[model samples]
Target: MNNIVPIPLSIGNTPIRKCDFLSEYFKTNIFVKDEFHNPGMSSKDRPAYFMIQDAIQRNRIQAGGTFVEASSGNTGLGIALIARQLGYKVKIFVSKSCSQEKIDKLEEAGASIELCDNSNGLQDFQSTQFRAQSFAAKEQNAYFTNQYYNTQNIRAHYRTTGPEIWEQTDGQITHFLCGIGTGGTISGVGRFLKEQAKAIRIWGVEPRGSILQHYLKHRTAPNAVRPFDAIEGIGRNFVPGSFDPQPIDQIFQVEKDVSIDMAQWYYQHTDIRCGFSSAAVLASLKCYSAAMRFHSDDNVLLFFPDHGSRYLSKLYAENSKVSTSNAHSLNG
Candidate 1:
């Protein structure tokens, strides 16, 4: 008799689903890299898994070591899932702005959660990151999986995500769209696609309040902190070290209400629930369709980084004040 063991979780390829609704609406071919199919239920699994494995190879993390990180939500969940399985103690310092559902999910995954005030905005390094850094510094055998600044974050996408998209699209993708948080997904994937096809246009999506759009347009960082926007996982008040703005051909800024509305619209039409950032990308595509002059033959690829279940308390709340029709009108 042959003995078999179960395959480990978090080791598989996620599928790319065609966005038929969006394709018909926009009159262009569109597809979604459905990253929610990942074991951690988000795209962060790719980088988190690779970063941890790289650290182990470098002897920076070993058995019984502690893993610490600062995350809004998804990255922390990814790290916790991998670290706990690998015999490491996981601690996540997260901003209070993160949904309670995410905090509860992290705790359910056996990670200790420390909530930090995000009211001061991203420029104030004393927010969540400083606290996480301080905790990692005190631990004798701790590894900080600093997703924002870690070069491995970019490398992981470059190695895995970029190739997956290229192969899935058969090198026919003309426009690559994604929301930028740590910027690894856009920078790495953009570099790969641009290398393969010079004419491929890479567009980075951000919430209206984020400084990235301004920074890209004016080539200067904002001096004042923008108003708090409810959308998470994409916009940043400060530029992260992993972010390489050079590969991005253009940046699109979407309003918070529009993101929320589009998220709801996607669920209603396609039954594929996505987070705010995913909707932001869709909304941006709709808003820019006229100017970009997308053709029916153009193959547009959008990255949906996480599932909507993680955002039940915020974007998917039952008592959301904004209506879908109003949001569509704003975008239209």
Candidate 2:
């Protein structure tokens, strides 16, 4: 809806509302920034818009030109959505491990798909990211909007999302919880909030197999790391260039089963239809709630990255046994 930016599509300024059920249990406010309101129905829309607009402004790309990016799912869809709006062509090199629904959505958005080798759902051997970069370089007039390394990714969230949250909470937010993917969301928003008030805690959630948690603890990646393909797009084997570790307070490593179970609970019980990685943040809250300092009046906000609809096949499939009988509970 930006006239000056040449994008007439609706994006950003999503709602921040309290999760009434979760708030009652925690004895404090639990707010979720619903990024589904974006034109692409995901938080990725913010950066996608910014990066594309930036490329256009710099004359690195032109109308009707091909726009390329390597994404797990949502980011590709964001670019694809915007590219179509601006009469640009999109080619996405996505992860082979991503859900079928994501692949279908990308095609629907007019993005040509290239499924790259994501060895066991983690980065390995000329990954999707590198493929996009190489292809963009070789292709005529093609620009690779690399979300992993793009500073515009962080700038998008910092300039818009962070300010929105701060204003929405009236600067009373005590904790900000988010899943660390490319590290842009948490890093950007966390830095902005910290600049405003250093007391505001920024907590990142990482899937069990991700190297980010290990990297944070020891300042180095493990020699051998396990692959976590259960959930798409929330963890990284190698730390991304966009990830600024200085703004992050701490990170919690979560399990795939628990994350999926939490997303399932939201689908069946709550009004919020959270994706796998968003549920990872919720699971982190459940697991680490006791350790955090929670006061009655504190506002704890969650950055819900996307809706659960795109994950129906993976998280809520008939054969998927990720959920236990007591999967819904915050208690162990």
Candidate 3:
């Protein structure tokens, strides 16, 4: 008989494949974890599964209740996937700035949606999250699964993503590259990798508009001190509670066009189509990896956050031109 056992989910434990384009560009063996293959079409599935499962065990939530939260896109999909499977209701609050495709997908999944107005010059998701919190507090049998502050978000990456990378690479991973959104994914994964091996370098990639890169560079920056970036799911207007700066070796600020180009490159180069932030991460990996002279003894790993399906309007617009309107300045 075969020793392979049945797995519960087809999404995670995704392929960590070597990137041909990136490897040629970087002159190093660069690998991308195809997180877009996840059920929710993003890496959020990892944390969302653990978050919901742990919430159930800890009695933080009960069945048939409403799971209320704010999301740029992917996290909402993750929660909706579990909510539908477990017979719960999900209400997602999204900023008006999020892509239209994301809004449609959440609704298609039977998630109730509230669109927040960012026309008043208020920061994007912060306004939405605030509204969501208020709504969750007033609603009956509602639980707010705050992805940003939730400790389970961090734990998810630590237990699953980090160990998986270490195992898949046969402990040869010298550098880990990813974009910081809620801070959960990178923080958890970086912390775990550092604990397993002290020499591992964890580098976080953020959009140029985000403060994370500036924070890493100057330990602080004006305006950017608040997590403000345009890329969905990977940049924050505020620092998440779960993010720890200690384990990070460096930060790279990626331009929107660079990310857009890389995302387009993915579709052209590989069968896999990934989100904007995923492209940003890979582009950053290419740039960073190329600078380093590594032998077969070294390894560089990059994470592809979500699928490109959610970003068709922005990244794969009808015209050949990709929009750069979302790009903001970190120094401002």
- Of the two candidates 2 and 3, the one with more favorable lDDT, higher being better, is 2
Q: What is the lDDT of residue 310 in candidate 1?
A: 82
The alpha-carbon RMSD values of the candidates against the true structure, listed in the order shown, are 4.0, 2.9, 5.9
TM-score of every prediction relative to native: 0.91, 0.92, 0.85
Write candidate 2's Cα lDDT for 50-141 as tens digits: 89988888888866889998898899999999887888899998877888988999999889999887622225546888788888989988
Q: What does the lDDT come to for candidate 1?
A: 0.82
User: Per-residue lDDT of 47-150 in model 3, one digit per residue for the tens?
Assistant: 77777776666666666888877788788988898767788899988878889999998999899988886311124434767777788889887788888778
lDDT of 1 by residue, 1-332 (tens): 22221224654367887888889889999998889888888998878887787777778866798888889888888888887887889999888788888899899999999988862334566678778877888988998888888898888888889888999888988999999988899998988888898899999999888888777777777889666465788888887878888788999888887788777767777766788799889789767778778999999999999888988766767743447457557435
| Model 3 TM-score, 2 decimals | 0.85
Best by lDDT: 2
The superposed Cα distance between candidate 3 and the true structure at residue 111, in angstroms, equals: 0.6
Clashing pairs in 3: 227-236, 227-237, 227-238
Between candidates 1 and 2, the TM-score winner: 2
- The order by descending lDDT is 2, 1, 3
